[model samples]
Target: MSNEYLYIKVDKNSMAKNKVVYLEDIAKLYSTDTDKINILKKQVVLTIKDNKPIKCVFSILKIIEIIHSIYPDVQVINLGESDFIIQYQPKKERQILKYLKIVMVSLIIFFGSAFAIMTFNEDASVEEVFKKIYELIMGSEKEGGTILEISYSIGIPIGIIVFYNHFSKVKLSNDPTPLKVQMRVYEEELDKTLIANASREDKIIDVD
Candidate 1:
């Protein structure tokens, strides 16, 4: 295996489901020799013993060193990111806590959005504008629960649904929802930040 080549492709970020993360969990490995590929896949990349959220960045050079320890002259090819972040989040089986969290977030989002909408409407004087339009249209004073109010109430939810492009597991299109897009952007940004900090702080695992 002196002249053999091993190819590795690693993502910028990965999530470890188990406490022990293997090479195959964070990266894709390939080699002409099936035996080498099989063994390489099981190589321990990292171990998580702490029962808390752990974020660490790893350099590809460390992986090369691991392979070199096994096959000294094997050429290692990296086709992915030079540095990648592995985040380990330990799972807890607290059903009540999970439901409580869900309820709290639901309440916060519900009330927060309602407050924002109300403030916007007040600032814009939506009711006054609606009443003016109603007077001009019907030649009379507008009462509560008029067609304008009913349509406004009905249209708000529909508009929100269309704008968000998602509702209760229902997808309006094949494109990703706005929330998912924002979350993805946030994850990528966070990974970059962690990787940069690791490099600057000299905490990233890399070979000499």
Candidate 2:
């Protein structure tokens, strides 16, 4: 195939002053022996005598510095064609409310099912199951709805207090303090690596 040539309008000021050299001219200088010269839209190409073709299409300034250091007499001629690389990243949301809703609904369904099973037991009445639950909770073996009546007046508030206290003790670490959970996780990972890499002599051998 016939080699295609691009007529690059050489900058008079750059060549005259010998200040900032354009990269496009570098390719043409090298193309005297080779026909694979291309002038990409935004790039600057540079080639030094007896050296590999230096493709400098992105940063014209950096390319000029490189060329002047190696071949001070050489001027940039043309930039070469290169594949542009790009990457994309996705954002993640820590939706605590969404997670909490799912957990709470699951808990309610599970507990409600247990409640239903207990209430519909062959020997136990709805009143009886509630009475048993109350007795278990209130530390009372009362034979009547005295516990239920008490629970309606006082037990609901007491249950709420108990639940609040338990919830507080759950230690979700929601406070603004910077806990080293990541460090602990790293330590666990290190331990796993150590276990995986341990020599047979270093491992605890189970003697029968």
TM-score of every candidate: 0.93, 0.20
| Candidate 2 whole-model C-alpha lDDT, 0 to 1 | 0.42
> Which model scores highest in lDDT?
1
lDDT tens per residue, model 2, 79-194: 53111111112223469978988899989977986676666653556566677777788797777557465555485546544544434356334542233456667755654454
**Candidate number achieving the greatest TM-score relative to the actual structure:** 1
Give the distance in Å from residue 162's predicted Cα in candidate 1 to where it truly belongs. 1.0
Whole-model lDDT for model 1 versus the true structure? Answer: 0.91
Q: Residue 143 lDDT in model 2? A: 70
Candidate 2's C-alpha runs over 4 A off are 1-149, 152-164, 167-208
Predicted candidate 1, C-alpha RMSD: 1.8
Give me the runs in candidate 1 sitting further than 4 Å from their true place.
Answer: 1-3
